[model samples]
Target chain A: MDHKEFIRGGTALSEDEIKSGKIFVEEDALDCRYAWDTGVAIGRYLAELKKGKIIAKKTNCCDRIMIPPRMFCELCYRPSGAWTYVQDTGVVNTFSISNIYYDASRVPSGEPNPMPAVIEIDGASKGMGIMHLLGEVKPEDVKIGMKVKAVWKPESERTGSITDIEYFKPY
Target chain B: MRKVAVVGAGMTKFARRALETPKELSYQASKAALDSAGMKLKDIDCVAHGSAPDAFDGIHQKGEYLADGCGGWNKPTMRVFVGGATGVHAIAHGWYHVASGLADTCLVVCEEKMSSAMPHAQAFFLTIFDAITERALGLNLIWIFALEMKRYMERYGYTKEDMALSAMKNKNQGLKHPASQFYGGNELTVEDILNSEVMASPVSRLDVSPVSDGAAAIVLASERTARRLTDKPVWIEGVGWCLDTAYWATRDLYYPRYTEIAARKAYKMAGIREPHKEINIAEPYDPFGYKQLHHMEGLLLSPKGKTVELLRDGHFDMDGNLPMCPSGGLLGVGNPIAAAGTLKLCELFWQLRGEAGERQVPGNPRLGVAQAWGDLMQVSSVVVMGINNA
Candidate 1:
């Protein structure tokens, strides 16, 4: 008959206990399944990545190729068409320093925090970027505009997921 | 020309947590408003309910789920959302119903149930980021605000002390408001805010609004019904609402241009050239301490970037030249998303009728404006009202 009992995670106590100030209940369940439809363009892009290839949609309006092809250009909101290839190298545009674990509920609860970076993927035009975890560098040593390279997972281990690349480290 | 007036209003007993379901809360509030308006659920031609997000309640299709609770059963009912602005937006929509002759009386309700979500409310806010982009950046919702606060401070040459002054003034007013979350608190000092736990750099825990569970509702009726309902029906003199583009990164962060545009539209309709001199009271949305100053700047009641100075000079206090947020605002009144905005409308109603005992602003105050801002700094909704002619 308590609200906390219906909640997904953590210990449940009686309302009387909480009201009496004898206990404070906190739930910690992080089980979240976000069902999202990636649509036609993105679905194809993900399939290509699974085949060990990268695809960028070409836009006639901007005369440029965009990664994770969108239905419309983010800048001009025009239609984009056809997949193109770009080398796996790009420069960092702007980045932030993060010293936190990616997700506690998704991973082992007590593991150490992961170093993360929003890297500008290589082979793309300037300012095009991807957010990938950063490894091999000390948290205190990470700086904005730092050069880094992606270290992909083994061919046997690659899944089309974002975790396909183990992390980005110093080039 | 058809004119619409607010016939009735109701709200839940605000609290940090409400044991009842949002439907139950909505039923409670809506029933009161309908009863006060001397109308039945069937009398409502249209119903508009505002809830900020499905994420807050952890229920998808929130509008559909909340529909029946708002008396939407088998009639024309729709949900309006603009983050924190949804509450006022609901009223604006209701005004259209009566003013356009589409409906004789409209039921408008705003509800938020922050307690229904798992973990803390802050945890739910983590999803506001692009999972692949900003999530890995170790960014909390506080980070965005802290960044904005830092930028606002740097650009406006506002010290943390000036921001603390707002906390003091609002909290003092909160003491009188029964529903205020921060009521009866000792005066906060500049050192208090700086020393508070830093959720993100420059944004202390004290700077944020509390997650609240509540609901508020109002009934808007045509001019004929307004005379029958009550002697003091508040008239909707002007309304303006607008949304900005979603590309927040490209836009300037210091000033809220959308609010200015929305205010201009509302003021033009209300036929006011000098807002400070003409408009007697205001309730500019203040989810955070510095946001009051930021929105005041956007409202143009104060000169560009000069609100902190006005606030410092006691210009916006309860008895100042232009009284603001006599209801204690989202900061003190507890931010229940959509309900917070409707609470402002309720405050305006109470203030204009001289019914706001203890919290009432001085003078024969007549016209007042309530504005709500939300949606990643993109949306603004304004409603200007006046006391019904005696």
Candidate 2:
């Protein structure tokens, strides 16, 4: 009979029984607002990343080139045809550094460890990439094929948002 | 295509916060899988339910709030998310409701609380990214397992002492598991997981998998209600699932093409054409220690660059020659993401019914496999069990 004595026994709760209100903690709040619609190929790729440009779409079934710019072609589901643009510079294709922070906490002893990567964007296709952030070197000198680029933020602090570029560095 | 079996199994203590309620951990793993299938929950006949996110139980339509604690009141129930392959796709949708004659007993369950997500449940895993391009790069979830363990240690040159020997052999087989949650009787090495704390750079902190709070269950039947409830029915021979493009950086983060196309559609529906020689125990979903050698080379059961020389030649220990994870899986039985894939299909139906006391595994095993993997590295879900007529 010992299937771990038929399971069930976990009642843990104590943070002073959820702050002394004697365990009745139900204070909601997740508006999770949205307006999203970046359609028509991520709305012309966020209006060509506020005109500093990056685009992509161009598809002919699956010769690649799709990027964060959609409007169809997830392997010839059709539509997507011409837009192109690309080179915000790329390579990295994998990187991490991180020292924790996105709520798993940690990162404070003299900061700078955020790294993040997956860059691969230059001229649209070969492994399409995008997850950003890698600023001005040294997380032991990056390198997963290095060569980075896209550090945007200027044109009157443009904001078509994906935080208007401001990151990928190394070049 | 009409067999289905796992007659019963259950779970719950893999804690790190579980003050019951997620419908009392789905009515204590669906009342210990309907009292280990001695049956009665009006002899079940359809339920399913497998959770993973309602943002870790801060509930919303969480399958109608976990349908009356999993017996799924008023019957014909359903709920089958695919992130962390929702408990083996809710036992492959209760093996398609008892292999399609539409239920002759089903059940299923699987829960998770993840301490009702607040400031830290890895902050709702940053809403599984890409909300406007990888959630604007604040990024979390151990930076995609430290960028897929540095593209699988730079395409198989391997190390981090070869992924801390799978977090020291799944936390030393989760110290003989009775529902382990990082089972602690000490041991852990490989220089204590290469001295622990690197949280994302070849990913450390003992290579991930913890955040838990659990529930797991199973029942399934048909084959004439599993030969009237049990004569050791582990059977559900095959089930598969796939998924792939969530554009997770346009693929190839060192292989797992949707766990080798869901292990070749469950080895072509279990006619089993050599899953590294007819599978014999494996629970592929480590929640990171190089995702158990990238799902043992995507469940073809170790090959692509030889799972770190067959995990440095112990060949996946727990008395080797193919015994991986032996229930100490989501790195020592805890990752409550869809009750850690139905606790690896209730530890392969108690290790194919010898009833896994002390996490069994010594070659009495008659074919097993459990796979889970999830979204943003894009889904996977396989199943395949055996012993009924073995």
Candidate 3:
């Protein structure tokens, strides 16, 4: 009388079973590419990075300053105000020293551990931040409210992208 | 609004990698649900479909590609997407279709094919981040989840073991579910979950739901049509959905305010003021072990920062005060994204009708709530169902 018994369907395929050549399987990769527009806010923000400066938008609503800058304020449904430069220093809102990579594979023991954090930038609206890597400090030393500064690539090597600032380090 | 009730539900076995194509998975689950309702495709008035990102399935215009498989052919076929919340939102859309005089019957279907995303589903998620700011930061999906989990534990002083018990609970619950990925022969303890490989300090490998390929389907009809189809119809008392800002960083990671707002909307419509007592059973989205606790608090079923204590007291057990995830949830049932949410609705349908058999809870439960959260940790969809229309 169990509903589970009457319930049915779905063919589970183990790796070995899939490779056993019993089922006719056709494999194809999703070959696709995209050119994502940086938009007026992000495009200008990225360009400012080459000059070794961080820029943010001061929205008309509540005078909220935002990074990863948007041309409009999401909450108030209005156009953002003037763009303003922000300090590169920030506080780590939250962070994690992860041993897993994007591919779901464990990091090799010898590889450097990745410490990713949401750094609440100074001069931006409260709790408004962008995610980035942490460096120049031991994983155990990273604190929630830790003050950090951007470690930028040499000016000549700047690429007008987020990578222009290599990582954030404890101030 | 008019009344709409769920007449039947169906699901495919949640598997790590289903050999069936996306269409085949949809067809199988759709067939089972239609058969359960004792109705044919012609009896359906319209179809509402849902699925996660096209990147996960490796197919563009997935809604169109999946239409025929879901019996949406030649009808007012439509797809509703809200990332992971697609499943529950599909039901909401179906309710709209039937409740607004558009149709007398509606079949809602949800599917996910994570196995087809070549390099890894996690890798595909990297592109989901802000291309200008986050994509270049070398982030995987684990970073954000771990960050949120860390913030939650830090705020509430919850330990790894505290969250691991949830994983253990759902794993145990899954044994009763026939379609569960961890259904039988695989029972785990709290220690096993704690000792497993840590993905990010607080989030262990076991805490994460398995990447699955499967589908789920449910049939909804207007009041008159539902009564004619089945004597024991589970009335869709209320449906609600909310989407918060995409700026997840600025949002509170310790609590999901979006889910609470969505739950409030549903509670108001269902005429239930006290959710912690009125609702008999609940299935909140649980892609991570901590999320079940997070969403429980979000649903107002348990007090904030205290769900862990209640969880430790066995309040969420199958026979406890409120049985949560009696269908094993995503942790044990296997998460195929969209299908997982729809399966939760199916759980409510079966449980409310007392047709769960051995998997049924001890109480003669009459009212239940199912919810799903998704899309940059910003959206939540909620549905309230009961034996009789409120």
Candidate 4:
């Protein structure tokens, strides 16, 4: 058992100073972990991305195409989905300010961070927004309908993961 | 269909950390509710349980694991989940058990042990996303709320300070609740909220509920059984629930239409013509401060993009024309996901019975509505309750 710090009479402390009290100490905490069974599919996708290729999937229902392939379309409920590729360019549809750094644990942790904008990729239609860090322009410099391009990592560092392309900046 | 009434409501001490096992926590609340209703386990014909996520408890098939504690043993029991909306959904499920004549009495329990999980509850939320698309992007749960809040602010011309008032108002109201954590009138200012830790852009730490460990249970009985038990039984007058598309990427995030649809159905069934003028009080799910305003608009208690103005005008306070979250809401009372919703139900029970005491609204409130939203914010469940409707 541990007793949290409570100041006595040494000096005055700001509320901000008192707020940082929980920054460090922790104990035997239980956490949940997930291991995907479909590792082979992920592995193959990474390999393709490393070769500098983009991927998509075609839903059998309306025959509409989707990126980052999937097995089923919850919307159409049709089975037997397959992979398709697309040209590697999309546009920013809508955006917003994210000044706080958050996750479940740390959000309640009472900390703070800079805000990032909600960016819609170029090729994606309206309402298909993905969260990625923004760079190359200030928050004031960013605007809706701004033309931005993905800043991909060096060829050798390309992986099938989202990190392959870093933050999107002014085109 | 038969009429249904809530005969009893019980809850564990709402806290930031509860050391008991989920089973133990479930037992504590379930037993209290049963005892309060002067009923035994044998009196329950069916059981309904709700837990927000197995990740919160670190157990899969959470319903089965917690079944025995909720008295589901060898009976017609089922677990219902709708993200954060599970608590109210459980109540709705229990209402059906008696309304459909499937059971004479139903035990509804909601429990969450967020403290049991480590690293952060934020990590578990990472999995709520699409593994390929959103998950790969390393999204936090608040990212959605922050983005939604930003959109709501933009659409309605609401300022960050306007949203902060919810935190101040709700937390202050919480001071009156015996089970509230941050009670004692520790007032909060908009500057205080803005200066507090930022969780996501435009969403501050103070603007959100704490990760809590608690449980709440309510007993729903058929009209006959309820009359036999007590004359002051709180009747479940109307119930409605809806789920929106799980694809968060495909819909307009500025407003939650699911909540509006659910509220409309409940209000209609309850014969409420104008919710704000008819209903005496409300408990809109407030896991996030801005959510209270967002859902206020969806519930039609206030006009679209006008809840912030209502809040600013002090129209939603305890002494306001229509008091809201008089139970402290999830923000001040602490949010254990499912249990938070049920606690709102309990608050309504007390309010309608004129037994809310110090935390109770000043007038004799005859009717109140409680709402909960969950599942990537795609589901809404509402329950309208009254003291004499039975």
Best-matching candidate per DockQ: 3
| Clash list (residue pairs), candidate 2 | none
Q: What TM-score do all the candidates reach, one by one?
A: 0.77, 0.35, 0.97, 0.85
**Candidate numbers sorted by TM-score from highest down:** 3, 4, 1, 2
Please provide, for model 1 over B1-390, each residue's C-alpha lDDT reduced to its tens digit, 9 standing for 90 to 100. Answer: 488898777777566776667887788778877866778887788998999878777678899999988899898998988888898898998888888999888999999888767646666666765554245344454545554566577677888778777765665676677556555666666677767754544556667677788888888989888888788888898899888755443345567888899899889888889887898899988888888888888888888778888898888988889998898888777788898999888788778877677787878689999999887667899999898444
Global Cα lDDT for candidate 1? 0.72
- lDDT (0 to 1) per candidate: 0.72, 0.81, 0.89, 0.77
Model 4 lDDT tens row, A1-171: 000010011111233543577333344545446676435445555566666665656677866564444566666887626775554555443454455334543422233233344555444334555556666677666665576666778887775676676767887
- After superposition, candidate 1 runs with Cα above 4 Å error: A1-171, B136-138, B182-187, B388-390
Predicted structure 3: lDDT: 0.89
**lDDT of candidate 2 over B1-390, digit per residue (tens):** 588888888888878777777778888888887898888889887798888768766677788978998889898998888777888988988898778887788889888888777767887778778677677667877787788789888876887888888777887788778678555566687888888899778788877878878888888888877887677788888888888888787776888888888888888888998898788888888987778788888888887988888888888787888888888788776788888988888888888777788778876888888989887768889998989545
| Model 1 lDDT tens row, A65-86 | 6665667776678888667766
| Deviation from native of the Cα of residue B163 in model 3, angstroms | 0.8
What ranges in model 3 sit over 4 Å off? none
Over B149-172, each residue of candidate 3 has an lDDT whose tens digit, in order, gives: 988998899999999998788878
Candidate 2 backbone clash number: 0
Ranking of all candidate structures by their lDDT, best first: 3, 2, 4, 1
Q: Rank the candidates by DockQ, best first.
A: 3, 2, 4, 1
Quote the B-chain TM-score, candidate 4: 0.97
DockQ per candidate, 2 decimals = 0.09, 0.24, 0.69, 0.19
lDDT of 1 at A2: 16
